[model samples]
Target chain A: MHDFFFYLFSALTVLTALLVVLCPNAVNSAVFMIVSFVGTAALFLLLDAFFLAILQVLVYAGAVMVLFLFIIMLLDVERSSRVRPDVVTVVAASVAVLLLAFGMGYLFLTGHDATAATMAAVPQVPGGANPMEYATASRAFGYGLFTKYMLPFQVAGFLLLVAMVGVIVLSKRLTGSNEAGKPSAQEIRESEVSQS
Target chain B: MNHSELLTQLSEQYVSTNQWCALWPEIALALLAVLVLLIDLFAGRLRARAVPFAAIAGQVVIFAVLLGKLGTCDPADSGLLFSGMILPTTLSEVMRLFFLLASILVCWLGMLYLRKQDLPRMEFYCLTLIVTAALMLLGQSSNFVMLFVALETVTIGFYILVSYGRNSIFSLEGGLKYLVLGGTSTAILLFGIVLLYGAAGDPSLPVHSGDSLNFLALEQFLAANPNNVLAKVGMVLVLCGVCFKIGAVPFQIWIPDVYQGAPTPVTAFLAVSSKAAGFIVLINLVTGPFGPMASLTVPLLSAITVVTILFGNLTALGQRNVKRVMGLSGIAHAGYLLLGIVALIQGVELAAWAVIFYLFTYLFGSFTVFGVMSHLAGPDDENQEVDHYVNLARRQPFLAGVLAIGLGSLAGIPPLAGFIGKVFLFVVAFQANLYLLLGVAILGVVISIYYYFGWMREAFFQEQTWPEGKEEQLAPIKVCLPHKVAMAALAIITVLLGIYQGGFGGGF
Candidate 1:
């Protein structure tokens, strides 16, 4: 059953990811990207990484997708015109795809037995505790994050703060008369009228 | 073990690993950034003047303190802190100082840039401070997680900075292009990190590691399995991501447009500090976890160096825009620096020092040129043409002299700091037996002189032919007192470093 569900979600992920790239409309591409993220979350669930799976959904699918959709709407991006691939581009892409397919095939065929043997050799957990139990618990992630990963956590906060400041700097309109040396909106309008 | 005992053990681990004292400079930088933001909030009318002064003053103080504490802060004595997340060696200490110096100059340039354009000034300083702090951390990071987080902070800071002149369509266009490209590179870097983690964490491997993201453990794993295909692919992908940052060929498509469009100070920041950060990270990887994979890296980097040198110089030859010329020539410099990396990989230990020296010379020369560019730039910052510099020597000889020295140094002319830097790198490359790469680099230098001197010609030798009513546009550029002092200091350093190598010149 685990194998069955893994294959199902893996297929869902690859298919939707392809659609995300193939979709001409920017909005549709973003929607397909969300579906791809959900499929990845489901695959993580199959691995019994319950905490990661939930975070994946909450962060990438929920929050990040909302931002993508918002930007798409704000920009009012039209359906992108799909340019026809020239002969050279088509040939080059075909060669790349063929090489990739060949490489994957070669690796799987020769390495299958080695992979099985390595899996058998994996060391068991101490005291025979279920590995999934430790990884799946939300508290385990919290402990790791607060303890070992404290520096990155703090830096990520600063990253978000910078993003916020940057958004305002890029988009904010200075309109007040109090702004030193800067032309107010009224002054700017008058200057424009004079120039015209 | 009892539940209470386990809890106590965990707390003990946390207490032992969290060495906050080692991170004082980074912490102080973050605080300074916040203080700048707060000052902007409350300073009201004086905010513009107050914020830059505070930011630059704070950075100068931190730089002094870090320099004083340099000898005592070596990781050789203290070992890795934060459970091997940060490894502060003598090199990282120097990088911290380098980044602070760059940030201070960038803020000063930002003040000059903001005077003409009506833009929000405070955020620029705040972001520069935060990004500098992150770059210092990036140089010291011993874990992939730390590296990624710090790198993202720097990249995001640059994205906002690149487009800070939001009123200009060119700035916005450059920002979007950088956004798309930078995001793609980050994804590639993340994917590579994930692959390495997966490969190293495989319990079936001969020497598997539980903490696969740590550089030391990953090094051990890689050393044990020198022929691991997965790890090799991961290493290449990681290098590709870094190459994008340093603007190597095939990944340098964004350099010309972005440099031409970004505010001059931001472009200077990207060219000097950002590129320096990328090289430091590359050096760390090649000499650390990727050390064992020298068989794969040396040949790969050699090929890239060849193409990057020839391509950068050839493309730069025909460029008329000064910014585009700087961007392309900077690529050729990256190629020269890559020679140092290749030498380091081939067992020349002193090659790393050579790379750092070259970066220092680059910073001095590039900033001097950028300082002049900022002074000469009109209201439309993006459209600085080479023709604008005609007869600059007659009009403003001080600025013209500084521009000549800066461009001459960048061209690796004799009796300039850039010449000494190239000599050291070539010596190291020769020691490593990279004869072909050395030849290509020399050829690249010869080719670069044409363009660098072309700009010089426009400034010093070209005759001015003003069109009707164009004399106002070509009026003598006024250089303020502070700017003159700064540019003079930079130019003097370029000449002084060329003549005297100080401590950095001893070993080479």
Candidate 2:
């Protein structure tokens, strides 16, 4: 049952990820990307990494996708008019893709034996703990995060704060007499529209 | 163990590992950043006058404290704190001081920059402080998680800084380009970390580690499995991500455009502090977990050095835009530094010191040039071209003289700090038997002289040919007292370091 679920989610992830890239509309691509993230979260759930799975959904699928959608709407990017690739670009891209596909195929087929052997040999968790229970417990994550990973966790908070400040600095409009006579977003949009 | 016992045990372990005192400088810097924002929030009218002074004064105090403690804060005594998350060594201590100094200079530059622009003032200083704190942490991090988080903070702060001049289209364009490329590099770096974690944590592997993200454990794992394919790929990917930060070739496509578009202060910050942070991380990795894999790293870095040197110099040759010229020449400097890294990997321990010394010289030289650039740049910050510098010597000899010393140092001219720095690196590289790389680097330096001199010539030698009626545009730029003092200090430091290597040179 676990193997079956893994395969199902893996296929879902790969298919949705391809659709994300292939979709012409930005909004459609973002939606597909969220689905792909969900598929990845499901796969993580199968591995008993429940905390990671939840974060994958919450952060990537929920928060990040919303941001992507907001940007697409704000920019009002038209459905990407497909620019046809030149012969050189087409040939180069195809050759690169084909080589990657070949390399991946070769690695998967041959590398599986070594990896499988390693996995089979290491069924028991180190320090005599039950891997499933330890991994599934949120308390375990809390302990690790607060103890060993405390510095990084605090630094991550600063990272988010910096990101927030950055967004405001980049997007906020100038006010007062120091506005420097620059055009407003609305004005620029109108001007662009008229020009088009 | 039962739940109560387990809880007690965890708390005990946390108490043992959480050494908060060791992180006082970082904590103080963060608090200073918050204080700057609060001042901005409350002071309102006074903020413009108050914040930059507060930010600079606060950092100067911290810098003094850190400098005083430098002798006592030995890494051997402290070992690893926060459960091996941080390992503060002599290099990291120096870097902490280095970052503090860089932040102070950047705030000074930002003050000059903001006075002329219509941007928000307080957040620039706030973010600069926060990023400096993060960079200090980055140099001290002994674990992958700590390094990545700190690096991301620095990069994100830069994203805002690079685009702080939102009124300028070029600034926004540069910020977007940096955001996309930086995010991609972060992903690549994270992927590499994950790969190493997976490979090293496999219990079937020799000397397998449960905490594979820690440098010591990963080093043990790599030493045991020298031929591990997964680990090798992961190491290469990680290096590639760092290369992007240092603006080495193949990862340097973003440098020219971004450098051209960013505000002068921000471009200076990126070129000096950001690049220095990247080198510190690279040096740590090569000397720590990736030490055992020197066989792979030495050759790989040599090839990159060759290309980076030649490519950076050749591309920089035709650039008329001064910032673009700086950007491309900065790439070549990265190549020279890469040569030092290669030597370190080849067992020349002194190469590490050489790299740090070079970075110090780079800071002095680059900031001097940037200081001049900021003073001369008009309201349209991005349009600073080489031609704008004509007749600069005749009009403002002080600025012209500073520019000449800065450029001369960067070109590795004798009797400047940069020349000494290059000599140290080359000596170390020679000790490592990197004769071919040494040749390419010298050739690259010779090529770089053409452009560096080209800028200097414009300032000192080029005849003024202002279009009729536009002669007023070329009037003498009023160099403010603070800027003059700062530029003079940097120039004096360059000259002093060149003449007397002192402790920095003698120690290595």
Which candidate leads the pack in DockQ?
Answer: 2
Off by over 4 Å in 2: A86-113, A120-129, A178-196
What is the C-alpha lDDT profile of model 1 across B79-166, one tens digit per residue?
Answer: 6588889888788888999999999999999989988887777899999999999999999998999999999999999999998877
Q: What tens-digit string does per-residue lDDT give for candidate 2 at B383-406? A: 999988887898799999999999
**Stretches > 4 Å off in candidate 1:** A86-116, A120-129, A176-196, B1-8
Sorted into a CAPRI-style docking class, model 2 comes out as acceptable
lDDT of 2 at B116: 80
Q: What is the lDDT of residue A16 in candidate 2?
A: 93
Chain B TM-score per candidate, please. Answer: 0.98, 0.98
What is the alpha-carbon lDDT for the whole of candidate 2? 0.89
Local distance difference test values of all predictions, in order? 0.88, 0.89
TM-score, structure 1 vs. true = 0.94
